[model samples]
Target: MSNIKGKLIALGGGDDDVLLKLIRSEICDIHSHIEVIATATTEPVESGNAYKEAFEELGCSNVRFMHIDEANAADTTDHIERISKAGVIFFTGGDQVRLASFLNSTKLLEIMRRRFREEEIIISGTSAGAAIMSDCMIYDGYGHYSLIKGEMKTTHGCAFIKNVFIDTHFAERGRFGRLAHAVAHDPEYIGIGLSEETGIIISEGNQVEVFGPGVVTVIDASNTRFSNTREVEENEPIAVEHLIMHLLVKDYRYYLKERLFQPLTQTMPKEEAGNVALPEK
Candidate 1:
């Protein structure tokens, strides 16, 4: 991650005016060349056109989209050429398992990673796209059963960043257990659970600035003193001690290198986060 020269974003979906404007001003201007990758969605054309229109609505006329199925996953003739021309690359939501597997070890993926590391290109994704940005990704897991020893499943991801795993639709889907399990096992990586209508923009390959209306849960297992994950059976519940969790809101920041959280200075303040009023029954 230290070598990365790009901006990486993990979005949890929905069209927010703030997010759109952020892309326009902070990410890329309307004149910047953008490429939308629809490899995750089964309906590539539909997803691709939708993003194209969204960008166009933001006055980004140069936005183009393409689908990389198994057929063309390795094509270097046109696909590779297009990537070289891109200033910002976006991935749409769909099946994360399919996206990672389809683009695995391909020349297309190779160049994309290379450009991301060497250039100031912005590489971003939503939902499944967001989930595949790490080297290890959870392909299958239910929130309800994730605490069990062997309930979660992971595979090699695109490796845009190392020692980190991402999960999308956090609040709506109740995916805390799965993320907990992942970090508990790995212990070194941080598990980021991004809720819908929310996302994080990773800058300098170490810090992430949270955006949108929802919460971003950061699961850190680095301080663990005890864990029975090594002794638990398949259906048995696994218990781990000292699994640290951080809740972040809009404008908050988290540093991957130091494993620290930054509350927007004096704007909202970190102490106020715990003072949220509960909903009346």
Candidate 2:
């Protein structure tokens, strides 16, 4: 039910170029007049520092680093204040399970919801950082082809994009199958498959744009061809149907509101098109 829109960059895995560019753009191009507050989860201050320094190098000021894991224990109001104030919030990926457990329902979570409303809050993370953005997240697994039952586990996400399930490092790990399984079971959801070093930018109006070097795959089930999801038993080879997949490269945009994919046009004239043609009896 959160209306505030933001940008999402789900990298396939490895590569810091796009992430750094996003940080610079969010801080310099967009929120040029706001303050920058940076923080990390816990135990891996090195990664957090790397992210903070990268942004700082781009001339972002007032950078504040919080030991979120240790400090977030007592209450969330403090965490909320720190997260909400910053112009951009960067989450250095470490352990998604730990991050979810700590932030779920906390004041921090509420602040994140508010930050998106008040200002242009850019949430970028790597590895585990990217996994927590979706309602159904792919955690603790390698890729989609390894159909080992229960190898990839699904956990609670920040619910930012409620309908879609996001998996990063997609092509690198061959994760299309894992996302397909999720879609097969419930064709109502959209699967966002981001490749390594790539990112997806969701504008204020929920328009999804693909950025970076690799590809961003969009699996839409609303008009899905078919899925043998229900036919197979649990943990079995999902009988997948003809899935409508859109593989987007750099600079392409997917507008969620229009329901029309940009730059790729498939033609079906009025006679054969479903909308303009009449049903023959």
lDDT by residue for model 1 over 1-281, one digit each (tens)?
A: 56789888778766545555677776546788888988888888897988899989988879888668766655668888888878888888899988888888788888888888899988888889899998999877797798898888889999888878889988888889999998888887889999888999987677788888889999988888878777788899989998889998886787786777777573434454334232111
Residue 199 local lDDT, model 2: 75
Instruction: Flag regions of model 2 displaced more than 4 Å.
Output: 1-3, 29-42, 70-77, 141-151, 257-259, 264-281
Q: Candidate 2 lDDT, tens digit per residue, 96-136?
A: 77776766776667677566655667776766677777666
RMSD after Cα superposition, model 1:
6.7
List TM-score per model, in order: 0.90, 0.81
lDDT value, candidate 2, whole model: 0.63
Highest-scoring model, TM-score: 1
Residue range with the least summed lDDT across 10 consecutive positions in model 2: 272-281
Task: State candidate 2's TM-score.
Answer: 0.81
